[model samples]
Every structure is written in C-alpha cells, then in structure tokens.
Target: MADNDFVPLTPREGAALGDDVYAVLGEAILRGTLRPGDRLRDVELAARLGVSRTPVREALQRLERLGLVEVAANRYTRVTEAHPDAYAHTTEFMTYIAGDAAILGLARATSEQHTDLIEAVDALIARSERNDGMGILGGTTAFYQLLIRATGNHVFITIMREAGLALQRNLQGWTQPDEDVELRTTRYRRLRDAVVARDGRAAESILMEPEPSALALRGRPSLG
Candidate 1:
C-alpha cells in the first residue's frame, strides 16, 4: 500500500477502532495495493495506520475470516491468493443472494424503487450490448444494491455490505457473454418487465439464471 494513502486514525472506542482498521486494510487488498502473498506485519501496519497493534491484529483476523488474508501463527500473515475458482464460487453466492433479495425486495419496494430497478436492468442491457466488462459489472452491482436495500432487512443489507469487497474483487471485469448478447438482453428485458409488474417470483428466476462463464468455470476440473 502507498504510505501516503493512509492517515492516522483519531481515537475511537470499542469495536469501531478495529472496524476502521479493517476497512482500511480490506480496501487496500481489494484495490490490489496489498497484493496476494504480501506480508502483513502488525507492528508496521499499526504504525502506518496510526493505530495500536491490537487493532491491526483484529483487522487482520477479520480479513482472514473474509478470505482476503491468511495467517499462520508465529510464522507469517499475508494476503491470500484469489483462487482460480473464486469467480465461480463468488458468483454462485451472489446469484443466490440476489435472487432471494429480489424476491423479498420486490414484495416491499416502493414505486420509485420499481422504476429504479427498470433503469438498472436497462443499464445492464446497454453495457452488455457495448461489451463493456467493467460497465456490466458496475451496472449489475448497482441493480443488486438497490434490490437489497429495498428489502429493508438489516441482515440482508449487512451480509451484502460485508461481502461486497470480496465480491467486487472476484467479479472484477465480469462481462456478459459476447455470443449470448441477444439472449442476455432478452432476459434483462424480461427482468425489467418482471420488476415493473412487481412479480417477485419472475424477477427472482431471472436473477438466478447462471452466466455462461460461471457454468464453464464450474465444469472445469478442480485445480486443487
């Protein structure tokens, strides 16, 4: 991570201090500043982030739990490599979450949120047509964010928030299938219609459709 990128943390009480430290290190890892296999020294991080070693240790533990870091007691702590199967794994998790969130959120969404969902799906289709990988990823994430928030369930919101970093890192550069652009666009349109009608089941089904790339990855033999 760049030395100047972080500033010293002001005093805070309880878990908030550790939470702040975790967000800093977690963001660095997601942005590729602290790359896979980079050593994480508590003392160095503590000094750099201007916090005590305790919070640094706590942060690393949280990152480890999130699979962004790995630790070996008394030997070393380092960022973990993104496994070759990470895309498929994270995508599977995301599909299920998005599907369920759509069901619940559609039931509760306001008319304004319904309009937002339509626009979001349109953006997804537009990005797909342009074959813009990053744009597609961004559009898809934004759609899911709106849906999850519409649910107004703290548990769903917190799960997505906590997992958001890992999801972005794993799904970066995700694109709609170039060959299946027409098919994907059709599905996206259907999804938009489903949202307009507030058909929870229909929307959930569309959201749960597996991407061709994810299917291909799942079929590949395990590297392990």
Candidate 2:
C-alpha cells in the first residue's frame, strides 16, 4: 500500500498513532483488503504509514492480540484466518459498543440522530433483502459507525476504530455462500429499533441472538 493511502495521525490533529494503526491496518486485514497469508514487513509498513517502527510494532502487537495477524516460524508476519478468540472478542466488543450507545443515545442523541439511524436501518434491511452481502456488510459498518458517532464520546470513536477492523474480519465468513438475508436483516431491523427507541434492554437481546449465525456472518463479525 502507498504511504499516501494512510490517513496520518497528528497528536494535535487528533487520534493516537498506535490505535489508529491498529484499527486501520486491522480493518484492512480483516476485510480481505490485506488478504490472508499476506506477508508484512515492518519497515515497509512503517514507511507506508509515515511513522517509525515504534507505532508499527505497537499496531502489530494489537493485531496479534485480536488474532488478525500471526508471526510465522521464520519471523514473517501475515494475516490469518479467524480464531476462536477473534470470534469471542469481536462479539463481546460489539456488544459493549451497542450497549454503550443505547445508554448514551437515550438522552444525548438528538431527534435527528434517531431518525437517521432508523432510516439507515431501513436502507440496510432493504439492501440485505436483495441478498447483497457486500452491501449489507458495508451498510452495517456505516450504521454502527453512526451509532458510535451518536454517542458523542471520544472513547466510542476509538472503540469504533478497533471494531471496524474486527467487523470486516467477521464479514469474510459470509462470502462463502448465500447467507440468510431475511433472518439477518430481521435481526438488524430489530436492533435498529432498540437503538432508536433507546431500548438498551432490547438491543442487548438483539446482540445475543446472532451467536448461532456467526459462521454465516463470518469475515464481518465473530463466529459463534
């Protein structure tokens, strides 16, 4: 990847290098943008990111923690297929985001935010009904990004940066075969309602219902 492709982080311009690196690079790896088994050289990455080895090392470590990248016997680093921990961690993290958003969105979100989220859900559900997995994947990410934005919390933004990468990784599992669009969209719609209604309880329930569908939703979310 070209160094210019990187969205640079300035301490003053906002965002931490390590976390930004973790989230951006992690999302690329997860979404097949980087691809499985792609070799990564720290020097090359550092150059591309316009940062030194320090941030790259930190990013690699964070990715390793998420199971998005692995070090080979020869000391080469490459993206890998999802592990059990990846699935577990991604799900848990997403639940945290949704739960937090639900709690904060209640009083904090403007009426416009609620309407926009509901509209996004409707659009996503419509696209999913068309059996467009790619569309669903992209839309889902955007919807959640919006959810985090609605919270108006800086932490949510960072959490979202991390979650975006995990979400893309989860999407990979869906590319195998046609997923049950109806079922998935149904869940998404319900989840959207919970958010709009500011119903943290129902949103929590919606989050829990998708575990069995993890394999189908793979490459985008954690597998059950």
Candidate 3:
C-alpha cells in the first residue's frame, strides 16, 4: 500500500494518553482507514501518534479485548474481520440492555436529565436526516449513555460500552439513506415523550422495537 493510504494521527494532547491513543486508533479502524488484517505494530503506531510504546501497547490491548483487534503472541496484531453472528449477537444484547436502561432511566431521570436526553435524540434525528452514519452512531450512543448513567448501575454502563463498540464496528459504512427519516424521528420522539412522562413500560417498548438488518454485512464473508 502507498503511504498515502494511511491516515496520519497526531500526538496525544489529553491527560489520558492511553485513552487518547485508543480513541484515535479505534476511530481509524471503525472508519475503515485501518482495514481487516492490516498490521498494527506498536512501534509503528507509537511513532505515528507521537506517543510512547507503552500507551500504544495499552491501546492495542484494549482494542483486542473489544474484539476489534486480534493479537498473535510475540508475532503480530491486526484488525479483526467482521463476523455476522458476532454482530447479530452483540446487537441483540445491546438492544436488551438498552431497553432495560431506558426503563430504568425514565424511572430515575431528573428534569434536567430528561432535557439532555431530548437534546441527544434531536441530534440523532438531525444526523439521520443527513445520512451521517458516524454522526448518527455518536448521537445514539450519547443518548443511550445518558440512559445507562441514569440507572446508576456501573456494570450496565460497562457492558453497554463494550457492546456499543462492537455494534459500531459492525455498522461501519452502513447507512439507511433511503429509510424513512420521518418515521425514525417520530419513533424517537415517542420514546422521549415516554421518558419525560416517566413511563418505564412505554420507554422500554419503544426501544425494544426491531432493528433493520445490516445490509452492509449481507454479502461479506464472516470470519471464522
């Protein structure tokens, strides 16, 4: 591959060097700038990001745990290929967990939290309208993060983060450009109303609705 094929990454500017490295590398992988089977060498990444090998190593290990990267002992590390079953299973888990969180959130959310959730959903609607897949994903994640946090359960938050990462990875390049934006907006509006009304059952029901199949994964070969 040409040098131009690789996207340049800047040095860490945040206090959490490990987290900063992980975020940059993870976004690159999710955006397909780092494709499946692409070599991820600590020395190379450290140099590219102007970070030390320690943080790069830590970031790589974290990505490995998230199922985004695979490592061969003392040999190599590379991005993992997509697996349909893994995607399906992870989506299912995320949906259930998010539904529970929605219910809990509605029951526990303060007036201010309700306003924040509404804003997040509004952002999601806007992103969806423009068919901005990454923006939509980010907005949806933020909305759910609020809900998960409202539950006051650290374990659910952790699980959601892991599942959300896998879900986003599987959804790379997937967009419902022709899907009805109005319908989506209305559905989320109903969910927001339910949350505001503190209707736990309704919020869960709204959130538990089936998701469309990932057309992007339809013809892709699954990794064994």
Location of the lowest summed lDDT over 10 successive residues in candidate 3: 213-222
lDDT per residue as tens, model 1, 1-61: 6678677887666648888998888888878788889999999888988889998998888
Rate residue 86 of model 3 by lDDT. Answer: 65
Please list all clashing residue pairs in model 1, or write none if there are none.
none
Q: Please give the CA lDDT of all the candidate structures.
A: 0.77, 0.67, 0.70
Least lDDT summed over 10 consecutive residues: which range in candidate 1? 214-223
Residue 135 CA error for candidate 3 (Å)? 7.7
lDDT of 2 by residue, 1-224 (tens): 44455555454356777877776687677445687788878788887767888888898877876667888756799887666566546555665666666666654777898788788778777876787666765666666666777788887777566555556575444442445657777787777677777786776567556444321233443254
Give the C-alpha miss distance for residue 220 in model 3, angstroms.
Answer: 13
What are the RMSDs of all candidates, in order? 3.7, 5.6, 4.7
lDDT-based ranking, best first? 1, 3, 2
Residue pairs with clashing backbones, model 3? none
Q: For candidate 3, report its TM-score.
A: 0.74
**Residue 109 displacement in candidate 2 (angstroms):** 1.2
Ranking by TM-score: 1, 3, 2
The TM-score between candidate 2 and the true structure equals 0.61
Model 3: lDDT equals 0.70
